[model samples]
Target: MKIGLLPLGRPTFDVPFAEEKLAAMLAALDATGHEIVGPRELLFDEAATRAAMAGLARAGIDQLLILQVTFTDASMAVAAAAGFDQPLSIWAVPEPRLGGRLRLNAFCGLNLASHALGLNGRAFSWLYADPGDDIAGDLKALLAGERPAGRLDAVPVATRSPDGARVAEALRGQKIARIGEHPVGFDTCAYTPEAVQALAGVSVDALALDDLFDTARTVPAEAAAEVRRAAEADVTGLDAVNQEELDRSLRLKAALETIRESGSYNAFAIRCWPETFTQYGGAVCGPTAMLGEGQVPCACEADVYGALTQLVLLEAAQAPVFLTDLVDMDAADNTGVVWHCGQAPISMRDDTAEATATVHTNRKQPLLYQFPLKPGPVTFLRISQAFGAPKMILSFGEMLRRPMAFTGTSGVVRFERPAGAVLADIIACGLEHHMALAYGDHRATLRAVAAELGLPLLEI
Candidate 1:
């Protein structure tokens, strides 16, 4: 058998020992008759994993052997192995605790990788043993086509709620205006529009960013003024932006409103990135917030699935959904920061002096929002469809008032469980970074939503 051998490690561990582990595993595998092809160097981070995976892919190895020499973030492992359709085996090195700091969280890391792979509908076999002492039994079974048994089938239809029939019916006719494709190399932003349509009764329509920009530029000055006046009362970072930049922002919102009207679009997934900042000279985050207040969700990064998730929470809670990245976690306090590049809406902002208009921190351009979100009970709901099945990830937490951790809007969330547990689930499951956050404890409703959609709701 032609085996693609990926010896994995982490910079957090001893790199030299990891390298030794890789060399030893290669020698043992070579002596067993299978032809091995892969990077001679150990994969210690994202760049190495990408380059190595590409090379192994080109080599056309029949099966993948991910030999974990030490603990690495689950993201690193999935980064290289995301699209691998071949049989996979993860050989985790048993850690010998030498009475110091934990040398390697090998099993924990492997556990995470497995959950992430499961999210993508890839089942993998795992062995916690010394690669140097492996018998032929396990290898033989794999050779004879014994595949990993963890099938990420749809989650059982959840117990129907009092509003179950109505919610499902409403979700069935949902439509999202996708304004552009995902940004370059953002694998998490990738989704199968068709699969979402088939599984959740959601349809994504292709729309052009340029068209929105054009319409926005032509919008009447008075209309833009109304938006600016409202922004002035609550937005804070306007001093950094020019009048023209602010005007462009209002125009963009006008343009989006026009598009929403023309297409009867119920929601939006926008490509708010280099183009929004470079060409338009503004960010769409504040406008997205405005739309959310009006019950029209706009997910940044043109993440269609994210928009869909927002729509789910919006309708269910009758409140705004803030799409954000789980940027930081305070293990001691069991809290994490939910943040995005100022894309959150004003309604979600905390009632503090910081609430108001903003510019892009790095670009120093006008039109992004700046504020911290209000502290309250919040629920997280997000989804991804890879390997042809949609998987849902969710959790609940209390939003805390914390200083701005990054540019734009942010919220400090204290999970129901410890931050470490939540972090582990997120890392191990390889869940997408963006989640639709809404205030209030709606676990029951979200659970019903998952059951109605027939997608597995894997809580973080």
Candidate 2:
């Protein structure tokens, strides 16, 4: 079979690591004795991807396999699926838990690609494995036109929480300020205002990313200093990073508070990405953590539904909630690692570790919170659009006492079920990558809330 391989990546991540992994992957594919067509180098943007796809189309490949080399938005994957008629598949490599940086966030790219393709009504197969692993069987299955399908289980019955009515009432008048649009091909962040209103009685207010930047610029030095002083109580090493950038990051907190108070918004969904580091010269992760600790949930990547999910969990748990990604899972240890760049609330920091001001692993901008999560019972929740409709997804787990799995805010969690089973369910269900995590067992309250909202509950 002739296979077309398109390698996608972003410059923000570790390009050297991606190149090494790409070379290994190409060598493994060559061992299969299949005709491999397309560029071996990483395609960093749409133009490169489109140009490569044109060549693959001319080659008349039987399958198109996307080599997700690093954490990239789903635009290129979606475009490839739209342009190609052949069967599609994605292969994302895993990085070791080096306790430093996430060298290649390929799995996250695959997760994003899967969600976008599902939303676009495109069918595809997926594989998460390292190049050195023996994946001949998996490769054969993909060549035989195999695809992963999520199995929907019956909603579980549980006792409703007495606070369900109050939580429902609280959601009625709440509003979320969505600053800027979600990144390209981030279908998981896509949401309909009417649906949100109907289900949660919440309103969404769209704002430009520049508006936040402008407000941040206007923040007086005194106000920023006040924020910095307040941060010193919970955070350490403020002066270790670039002082100018640190001041800029603190100003972002002041600016967000201004917008939140003036707009009467209960939450924020921010496009906290390339611009925050590339254009604004600071990171918003630290500011997001501060606001979240103050009960104003902030979702990254302008994920509106993620903010709403945080709100729901916050109401249910009545505590600080962290929106995180399930980065790594190990069946042998029955543990899965939940992590984010650096936006977890300071209150969730482990007792043994001090919350330190840090830089983004990839972007290298200051003002991100770095610490392991506290060990305790936890509840995971998401307002999911998987399967093309909104539903309630819940999971119960316990954060184990362990060393930090990787850089930024991360925790090792043991779910109610086996790690392998949970991983399989997550992939099969095509769940969104972001999950709202609140420390403590609030499963009952979440169930009651889901019941009150008449949303289907899928507990994995």
Lowest-lDDT window of 10 residues in candidate 2?
149-158
lDDT of 2 by residue, 51-99 (tens): 9999998999999999998988888989999999888888888888878
lDDT comparing candidate 2 with the true structure? 0.88
Best by lDDT: 2
Q: Deviation in angstroms for 188 in model 1?
A: 2.0
Q: Compared with the true structure, what per-residue lDDT tens digits does model 1 show for residues 146-219? A: 63534433355557786645566788877889887776544566677787788778888988888777888888
Each prediction's total of clashing residue pairs, residues at least 3 apart in sequence or on different chains, is 11, 2
Clash count (model 2, backbone only): 2
The TM-score obtained by model 2 is 0.96
